[model samples]
Target: MRIFVIDSDPSFQGATVNVTVLPYEPYWDETVEGNTTRYSGVNYNLLATLCQALNFTFRRIPTREWDEVAHLVEIRKSFMTTVIYGVLPERLQRWDFTFIFEHAGLYFAMPTPVIRPSWLSFYYPLGGYVWLAILVSTLAVCIALIQVMVNEDMEKVKNAMCTEQMQ
Candidate 1:
């Protein structure tokens, strides 16, 4: 991908190219140990590879905020950023972008499956039929209970009729 089209010359002759760094996981990760700062990941690795190819050293201009990187690069304060910025029409008018290094997609991570005992796990494999049977049985039991309750009410009426017949 054309990271930057060097019209005059591709080689920097060991000159340092300034780059803006933002910590984006998997793309770029910034680690600071004492006074020295280190960067790793795909984007950082890409920048390092480019630097080696073009015979130029790179200096990272670290920034916490994202907007600052765009502003710095826009105003010519920095050469380019290693952070993966999406190419939009508005942004395209202001800056140049390399070919798409990453694609957009959704990824879902499933939780680790729990180990189950063979005896208990066998019950889990039962299909929807078991659930259907349980539901039907439950409904049948509820209907039976309502009928029994209604019969109890009829018993009171039967007792009153019996007392009237006795009188």
Candidate 2:
């Protein structure tokens, strides 16, 4: 049997990078075991895997809130962060993102809307004065039509009386 040796890369030299961690459940969880702080979850696992594969180490940056985590990364207080931030357009402009390995779905729900009767749409746009105007106009037209019909009937009666006298 032959003996083999593996050598570490000189580029990384096991440099420690600063990483900010927030205890987001399912993605990140920070636990205290005895005196040492232990982190476990999907995000942390990914970070650990990257460090191991790249031959580099990372130091945890302490933060209290989600905003602080982003602030630390934004202000260069940390080299990176271990959390799943939504990839927004503004965020993409400021930072580089890795390929998406996981997805979380968001849904918006509201109470069912109250539906008014469809016929009510006709009156919705009109106010009290406008509706009164329409009613008056319609009645005026009907009265005018009745007057014209009555005048025509009187003219026929007069013509008949004149014809009978001529006979």
lDDT assessment of candidate 1: 0.85
Could you say which candidate leads in lDDT?
2
What lDDT is obtained when candidate 2 is compared to the true structure? 0.86
Per-residue lDDT, model 2, residue 157, is 100
| Backbone clash tally (model 2) | 0
User: Each prediction's Cα lDDT score?
Assistant: 0.85, 0.86
lDDT of 1 by residue, 4-74 (tens): 66567668799998888787889888788999878899988999999988889888887879889888988
The stretch of ten residues in a row with the least summed lDDT in candidate 2 is: 4-13
- As a whole number from 0 to 100, the lDDT of residue 140 in candidate 2 is 100
